[model samples]
Target: DLSINGMWTERLEDSCEKPDEHPTPLTKQQLEQLVRSLILVEQSQELRILAPEIKVLQEDLQLKKANVYRSIPYSRFGSNRDAHCYRKAFPYLLAFKVSCQEWGQVLLRRKEWDAVLEHSLMAWLYTSELPQWDTASHNALREQCYGVLAAHILTALQHCSLEPSRGHELLRRLKMAQLQSQSIVPCIQELQRILGWAQHLDCDL
Candidate 1:
């Protein structure tokens, strides 16, 4: 039996009997090609070019009974040492990174500071789906997401004034994510500085 995204095809009995006994993993060349296709798709905004590769990869993962976003385990003394465990899901994460960056660039270019901040916060919220392993690679990706969030917050402060209620709501969301206080201190300080200056100007009026 072969399944690709819920549509299953029945094979000969002999093939069906041992579907899981020996699943064929994607080759390194195939993986690289898929990643290249993903990059091209993102760059050109052409989904059709990558559709076939996505189907093949999806079928391969389905046969292996693997989740596309599954958390890969790593160990120094085991078969899954390092990010080799990320074999099947590397493209997915790369696609995510690319998409987030592109969105940030577009929003920044438009000077849509509030939209950029919201988009960055949304990306940070999605980081929970990433592998939680303490590996350097995984931590770096998480930090990148955090950096996007923090950078946008500061940028938005510079370009537009945030209402006190909206600012508090943003802080609430960050707290919900359990982000480190230091990571957001610069944003807080900048917001305070702007609000204080606004108050002083109002008093002069």
Candidate 2:
């Protein structure tokens, strides 16, 4: 009788603690509030991660801008030159360089073979603005930057595993532009040499 009573009590407690067959419905306001709270939490988390990235980006941009400004010649252009030519060219040149570097970095990260080819061609377009010499030294810093840009393009082309006809066109334009710069024979020669190497790349795909 004692054992039977214990068994009966256990069964009663089990049934009482069991979940209901039908669940209670949440109110519309309650649902909305829950969603809003979740959104706030998610946004707060994203802000925490993005804030530091944004700060780093701002610092990098300031450094790049300063480098560009330093490269500009403060002396006025020749008597025959337009007074505002340098002023007009300065900002555009800086913007172009920054865009080129950032885009190159993106291509390096993506390793998109075709895009790498496209970037390589785009790089030549910017090369025109890079005079062999500017402000003191061999422009070693600038050249290194361009070299890294070139490497990224090369790596992307290699990893993308595809043909780069579109990239070929960009190189063609660069070659033509370089040819037109006959006064700067060395620039033309250097560009031609680079172009030759770029043209012969065997894409993986």
Candidate 3:
């Protein structure tokens, strides 16, 4: 029995001493494919988790007729008639704003200039769709949103190679926005200046 045990142990030792085979290193293309697959999987998982929350928020916004760009305080049990129910929508509006900003950052990183421009313009349009509230807080929020959009627009315009027709179209959209004229004016001017420079350089060439 001892001799048999010794023989078994020797066999195990020999097996352990043998060199183990290593996997061949992945090719560059294969590694890239793997990374893309991993990214897709992560994005899908994130979507699944966020979808229900998004639906709930959408329903809440619909029910409240909430303007995601505006915030007003809710009336208390014995509050004056001037107080409104806009506070209920504040959280949802905040979420929407955060989501938009995050998406904008992603687009900026990817250098999708056209999409970035469109995104900022769309967000600015949404703010303008609501009535202007005269309160300081409301004015500040509106200006802040406009400032962000203006920055995004400027960045897009500076980086994107826009054709004459596209530049004219952008100008038309900026004109249509009408709100935050100060912010919008600068963006319009910048776009025109960039286009002018491009044309001048082309003429020189």
lDDT of 1 by residue, 1-205 (tens): 1221232212211222244753765454554454444444443443244222323333333332333344245456775424666643554454455445554665676677777677666666565556654366655655665666677767877897678787767656654554532465566556656656445433422
Off by over 4 Å in 3: 1-84, 131-134, 197-205
Work out how many backbone clashes candidate 2 has: 2
TM-scores of all predicted structures: 0.55, 0.36, 0.55
Candidate 2: which pairs clash? 161-205, 162-205
Residues 1-205, model 3: lDDT tens digits: 1111244224422332233532464443543344334333433444444222333323322322243333445445543212143333333334334434554555677788888887777667655544354344644545666777787888888889988899989977876764445687767777768667445433432
Higher-lDDT candidate of 1 and 3: 3
Q: Give the Å shift of residue 156 in candidate 1.
A: 1.7
Runs in model 2 lying further than 4 Å from the true structure: 1-74, 77-99, 131-138, 164-205
Instruction: Give the runs in model 1 whose Cα sits over 4 Å from its true position.
Output: 1-82, 175-182, 197-205
Tens digits of per-residue lDDT for model 2, 65-118 = 444445455665452123343332333233434445554554455445555555
Rank candidates, TM-score, best first.
3, 1, 2
What TM-score does prediction 3 earn? Answer: 0.55
